[model samples]
Target chain A: MLAIRRTAPDPDGRLTGIEIADRPAPPRPDGWTTVRLKSASVNHSDLAAVRGPGFEPGTHRVLGIDGAGLDEDGNEVIVYPIVSGPGYADPLYDPDLRALSQGLDGTWAEEVHVPRANLIPKPAGLSWDHAACLGTAWLTAYRMLFGRADLKPGETVLVQGAGGGVSTALISLGVAAGLRVWVTSRDPDRGERAVTELGAHAAFSPGARLPEQVDAAMDATGRATFAHSLRSVRTGGRLVTAGAVTGGTTDLDLADLFIRSISLHGSAMGSPTDLRNLARHCATGGARPKIDSTWPLHDAKPGIARALAGDQFGKIVLHCA
Target chain B: MLAIRRTAPDPDGRLTGIEIADRPAPPRPDGWTTVRLKSASVNHSDLAAVRGPGFEPGTHRVLGIDGAGLDEDGNEVIVYPIVSGPGYADPLYDPDLRALSQGLDGTWAEEVHVPRANLIPKPAGLSWDHAACLGTAWLTAYRMLFGRADLKPGETVLVQGAGGGVSTALISLGVAAGLRVWVTSRDPDRGERAVTELGAHAAFSPGARLPEQVDAAMDATGRATFAHSLRSVRTGGRLVTAGAVTGGTTDLDLADLFIRSISLHGSAMGSPTDLRNLARHCATGGARPKIDSTWPLHDAKPGIARALAGDQFGKIVLHCA
Candidate 1:
């Protein structure tokens, strides 16, 4: 099996950070099954996994959290990465929760093993690449908008950082779900393209005031956009966050929180049910994941470099099979 | 009307900061009515208004937010300090929301004028002091626990800063609602008394690790207890805050937030309905507001000093008739 493995952490900003290696096919643990990967998408978590402390030192680890593949019986499946605890109905409540590439080998390979429960059937209409994107970024955006923020249709939402995988997903999904989707970007070109390509209602420069406050604001670009995200929502509105790419630490004014009656919900990747619902929504609603660029499994360096530089607009995928 | 008024903002620490003045009674605005005061309670917000920035300078503003008095019809009423906009069912959702002492002249006088809608009938079984306590601190605590956190009975909650008015309310309300209430205080005596007198399940020193994580953690002491509050809740739990007496600014680790799936809710003094529910709960549930000490309105200096020093374990009341 051909796998893209992170041999060393990318501390010094080196390009070609990953190496393609011929590895043995993934061994299926009891109750788990091996899937031959058809497509996989890169996420910021994959970049973090490549950048150190996410995996042990001196150990070559396969890197990717989002993938769509086929089981031994030739059934197409979208892999849910979050491994749940026994008897817990919601994986979010599981204390010992671990996600793929965090604690287990992930889906950046020709063959990967995952729990049987983690497999959701990929719809016939959903393409392999779009199904692959559903595992991480799309699912996160889905949960942030629908599951965590609980936004109603016809309400407004602001997506900070319009060019990233999650922001693109939020804009498309929010628009598909009947939300007035606004976005912000550092680059005006990206902001304009976000409206034209991803169906955002409008786009603004970072920190530019919106004409009206939104019911909810999604922030994944943490420190850079945290204050804007907080200010963008209306009173009693929600500020939902999943990741902080620029940095984590941000100043929070407690008075603004209480006086405005804001609810800040912090979400991670999502529950398996959320992934299933996301797949179903994308399949039935005709919403598709935007792909930035794709590279064959043997030559994933350019895709890795593009993702690391954040130079692309959407999910960077690899044709793994 | 005899009122405790702050004649000037206190930029520097000043003792006996407020003056008891013989002033004209508040003129009732259209659609507003006068409430002849019976009892009023001091909150940290009152102290803030006296200090600076919270209130307009040099306006001789009355300095209390929580009060119980008699309406023009001689009906005993608890003043709901948060004024709501017309047609908005939830006052918290009102963009022009302003609480007593923030934008309006507050309670602390022999008589104060308020919107007629801001008065909830004081339950017959409730004491004037306890009813007064409901307008601010107790209501904030009630909303933080019940409305914001949505805590179920039998869930555990940690109240940070055990001696303040809100902490006392949370301890009593949480206990009365069948929650396992834990408290933390800098003073060992206060912590011990919180357990013995306030019916807390346990008490710990500030930042001390609890035996187990709580389902919800309430914080009003901002910088001093913010980190501890974040650390005290279990994954997928809530940290609800209403005020930040110690300081407003705090460092938030965004990674810890999303990874743990914590919800941070900021609740101000609750709605009129919450005040009514709190009064009814205290009346029927046999829960009484803990009054630390009382002073006649003529000699409110010591009470103000005690509250400013954070020396009291419960509400500081001004006996006005």
Candidate 2:
């Protein structure tokens, strides 16, 4: 099978980690079956796993977290990325939780193995590219907004760092759900496009004071925009985080956090229920995951590079089969 | 009328900022009525107001936040300390939320003037000292456990600092409400007392590993205990904070917060509804605010000194006649 695997560290900003090569077919375990992967997408998690603590010199970890595919029984489905850590606990809370590429071979290949439970029927008419995006970044945005923050229609949500996959997903989903969506970006162009093209009500320069504090906020850019996002939420509002690309740690002004009754919720990916709802939402013309660009399976390197450099404005996809 | 007022900062820790002296009787304005204060209790807010940004050397701010007294109609009542900031908005959310001493005169005097709505009838069996403790610290604790964290009976709650007013109130109220209460304190004696005297199920040294993560936590110790409190809650659990005596900033490890779905809620005091509910709960003997000691109204200087020194373990009372 043709696949993408992480080969080394990009620690010093070399960006020389990914390898597109042929790999063995994934074997079926007791409850696992193979899917003929049709498409996959790049999430920061994929790029981050390589950028951070890289694989041991000899280890070539296969590299995708989510995908859309045809199951062994010929059913079209979206694969749930989490490999159901021991005890079937929520993957985010499990100390041993592993997404597709974390421990097992991922769906970047032509064929991949997933538990039967990981397969959710892909609604007819939802594209393989869009369905491929759902299980990781899109689902993360879903959980952060609806699951963790419990946002309501007609309320406002501020999304920080406009170009990332999750940020775009948040804007699209937030707007689709009848929210007053606002987004922020370091790049004026990205912020403008978010408003003009992504249905965001408004956009602003990073750290530029928002027109008003929002009912909730979404953050994936950690150290840089965290304090601003915290400040941008109205009193008693919440901010949900999925990934921290710039850095992880932030100074928590306890007075600001508690005195204003602000709450911050850290999110990873969605639960099974969130996944179902996300699929239903997308199928029902609710929102679409913006596709930055798509490449053939053999041409994944460039797509991964664009995503890894954080230059892409929407989810970057690979047509696997 | 005799009252305790803050005259200056104890920035050097001299603890001489408080003065007990005779003052003019409180004047009732339109929409306001005089409450002949029978008892007032010392809270961290009173101690903190002096310890932090103190008043002008020439200015004297009457020092108590909550009190039990007689209304103009000679009706026995517990005075709501919040002065109904500006638009009568939620005091916690109001930028101009002045809780008594923050702007106008507070409750630590023989007679206090407040809005007519400030009075909740004192239950015949409830002691004045206990009722006096409710509006600030006890109410803060109630809002933290119930209003903010939404903690439930039969669940476990961890109190980060067991000796302070809010911490003790959390312990007593949580236990009385059928929760499993656990407390932490730097002093071995305080930890032991919280378990033995305050009905906590267990006690731990600060940052000590708990037998299990709690469903919720209450924090007022700020920078000192905030991180540990964040780490002590189970996944999707909450921590409510009311004050930060040990300094106000802390490192928020966003990963620890979101990956575990931990939520931190900053609470100031209770809502009017929460105040009424707290009174009903206390009237039904759900919990009693621990009274560390009592002093005659004229001897308030010593009580203020004890509270400011952080040597007292519970609510300190000024018995005004």
Candidate 3:
């Protein structure tokens, strides 16, 4: 079986020691079953494993957090990225909580072993590529917008950084849910495209003074956009964040936060339940993930390069067929 | 009648421009009446007017934010510190929202002209000094705990600073509300006193690791304690702030905040309705603000000095008889 693995971590360079090699098929654990991969999306976390601090240091590990596949029964499904033990009140708080690639053989292989419970039935109308997007980034955006922020229809949301997977998902998902979605981008082209192409209500240059503060602001770009996100919200508004791809530590004006009655919530990826709801949301709204490019699993370096160069507008996926 | 006023704006020194001078009593406006102030609490905001930026520059205004007094009809009352125009939904959001000292003659006088609606009935059992405490700092603490944080009883809350008016009030009010309150202090004596005297469940040194994470953390100490407050809460825990006395700007690790699903909420003083409920909470629980020291209105310098020096355990009051 062909597997994409981070053979070694590159602290200072991109694609330091990635291996596209042949390996014996992995055996499934009890209550787990084999799924033949149809498609798997390349995520920032996948890049982080090879380019930054690998989750399991010194050990080579396969590196995909999400995928669409066919179960043993031939049912098409999307693997829930997070792998946690059962009966936990909320899997998010599970002591052993971790994304798919963290502890198990990941989904970026021809055949992968995953918990049966993680196999969510992909909607009949959705394609494998879109289903592949639901397990991580899309699910994160779904939770941050709906479950974490409790944003409602007709309310306004400001999205900081208009180009990333989570940010683009937020704009599209929010728009489909009847939210007034505003986006900010340092690149004028991206900002303009966000309004003209992504169904955003408005778009502005990063940190530009808004006509009026928004009901909430979403930022996954972290330090680069955090200050602007803080300043963009109305009093008693919500600010939600997922990954801080730029920088993590940023200055916060405590008085501005408290005096304005703003609530900032930190969120990571979502629960299996959230992933299921995200699929329903996308299916119901006829919305789909934006795929920047796709490549065969054996030839994924070019797609990875596009993501590393920050040239992709949305997800970069690899097809396993 | 003698009134405590900021006769001149002092940008550098404490009490530098404060005046305990004789002035004619103030007149009431339409829809307003005179309240003969029995007692007034000196707040941090008062010292700020002389030492930092006064809310309204070039205005030699009276300095108090909260007062307990008798209405013209001899009805005992405590003036809600906020004075805003009528018909505005959520006075906190009102454009005309200002504290008693901001745009009007403050309550640190023999007689203050206030809106009829700003008067909350003083409980018969609450002392004049305690009644004075309910209008600003106490009300702010009340709102931070009950209104902003939505902290349920039996949940543990961490108070970042063990002293200061709001911190002390948080301790007392939270304990009375059936919460398990923990406190942190730089001063060992204060930390010890918090547990022995203020009914706090436990105390820790600033930035000291807790035995376990708390459900919520309260911080008004600002830059000095913001990081500790951010680190002390449980996953998805709430961090509520009112005033940032130390400094307003502090570094926030967005990854720590978002990855753990923590919520940080910014809040100012409570609304008039909150003020009324605060008074009732104090009265019903038989809880009262700790009066650190008391002074007559004519000789309020010592009380002011205690607050400015951060030597007081709770509130400083000036009585006008």
Candidate 4:
């Protein structure tokens, strides 16, 4: 079996550390099962692992957080990445909760092992690539929009950073769920394409004043867009964040938060329940994960390069068949 | 009539700008009525107005945010301090929301005028001073505990800063509502007294690691206690803030927030509904606001001094009767 692994972390967040090489098949632990990988999607977390400080110092670790594959009985399955304690009904509440590629080998290989409970039967409506996309970026966006923000139909939502995996996921999912979705991008072309390709109701330049206040806003851009997200929400609105791609620290004006009655929610990759709901919605609603590009597993370096460049509009996937 | 007013804005927050003087009674507006004040409590907001920037410059503004008085009909009432646009059911959502003493003459005067809708009839069970405390500190505390945090019974709540008006209110309210209340204070005597007099489960020095994590935490001593509040809450718990007596700005670590799934809420002086609910609960539950010291309206300077010195254990009041 061949696996894509990071021999060392890249200081500049490039693909220099990523390599494809032959590796042994993953072992099936007592309560775990193995999945023959058919497809895996690249996420910002994968890029982040390649960047630095995520994995241990010297050990080579396979680097993927999301994938779809076939089980031993030939059943198609979508893998949930989080590994937690026994009988932990909600992994989000697990104190020692961790996901793949953080301290363990991940899914960018021919075969990968996961706890039996982490596998969800893949719906026939979704392609293997789209199911792979669900495990990381799509599930995170789903939780941020529906589970955390609790947005209602006909309400407006502003998504900061129009072109990442999470931003694109938020736009498509928000639109399908009956929300009026607006997006912001630093690049005009990306902003324009968000409206046309991703079903966003409108798009704006980054930090530009919105035409009217939105009921909620999703910020994955962190310090660069946090202030704007705070200012653009209507009174009593919510702002949900999953990642801070630009920077992690920001100034929070306590007076503005309480006087305006806004709620700030910090959301990470969601619960298994949230992933299940996301898959059902996508399967039934005919919503599909947008793919920027796909490459064969043995030739994944160029895909990693494109993801690091961040010019692509959606999830970059690797075909493992 | 005698009133305590801010003579001018002070660059430094001190009582030098506050004066007790005789002023003409305020005229009742078309839809408003006058309340002959029986008691008014000193809040950190009042201290801020005296100190600087919260109020207009060169205008002598009566400086009190919480009060109890007799309406024109001779019925005792608690005045809701917020004034909003016509037909506004929820003042928090109103764009033009303004509180007493921010621009208008507040409750420190012998008589103050307020919209008829802002008055909640006082129950005979509450003393005038206790009712007076409900408009600002108690209402803010009630909203922080019940409305914003949405804490359930048996959950533990950490009330940061034990000596202030809001902290005392939170302790009593949380305990009365069946929550396990823990408090933090820099003064050992204050922390000890909180356990004995306010029914707190335990008390700790500021920023001391708790024996156990709380389900929710309330921070009023901004900058000084913000990091502690964030660190002390359990995963997925809430932290609510109303006033920052020390300072307003704080560093928010986005990664910590999202990874832990914590929610941060900003609360101001609560709505008329919350005020009414708080008054009813205090009246029935036998929970009363602690009065640190009471002075005659004309002799309020020393009371302000004690409040500014931050050594008082509870609300400082002015008796106008």
- The candidate 1 chain A region of ten consecutive residues with least summed lDDT is A9-18
Model 4 pairs in collision: A258-B266, A258-B267
| Model 4: how far residue B9 lies from native, Å | 8.3
Q: What DockQ does each listed candidate score?
A: 0.64, 0.48, 0.52, 0.63
- Cα lDDT tens digits, model 1, B233-281, are 9998999988888998999998888988899998887888888898998
Question: Which candidate model has the greater DockQ, 2 or 4?
Answer: 4
Report the candidate with higher lDDT, 2 versus 4: 4
Candidate 2 accuracy as lDDT: 0.82
Task: Report the poorest 10 consecutive residues by lDDT, candidate 2 chain B.
Answer: B83-92
Question: Which one wins by TM-score: 1 or 4?
Answer: 1
Model 3 agreement with the true structure over A289-312: per-residue lDDT tens digits: 888889999998888888887888
Give TM-scores for every candidate, taking all chains together and pairing residue i with residue i: 0.83, 0.83, 0.82, 0.82
lDDT of 2 at A85: 59
Write the residue-wise lDDT of candidate 4 on A1-321 in tens digits: 799988876879766777799977656678788889999988877877888676576777888999999998999999899988865446876778878776667889988888888888898899998999998778889999998899989999999988777888899899999999999998999889989988899999888999999999999889999999999999878999888878989998888887788899999888888888899889988778888899999998888888888777678999987
Give the C-alpha miss distance for residue A188 in model 1, angstroms: 1.5
- TM-score of the second chain, each candidate in turn, equals 0.88, 0.88, 0.90, 0.88
Ranking by lDDT: 4, 1, 3, 2
The candidates, ranked best first by DockQ, are 1, 4, 3, 2
Model 3 misplaced stretches (Cα beyond 4 Å): A1-39, A50-62, A69-77, A84-96, A109-125, A147-149, A292-313, A318-321, B1-39, B47-62, B68-78, B84-90, B93-96, B109-128, B293-313, B318-321
iRMSD of all candidate structures: 0.8, 1.9, 1.6, 0.9
What docking grade does candidate 3 earn? medium
Candidate 1 has what TM-score? 0.83
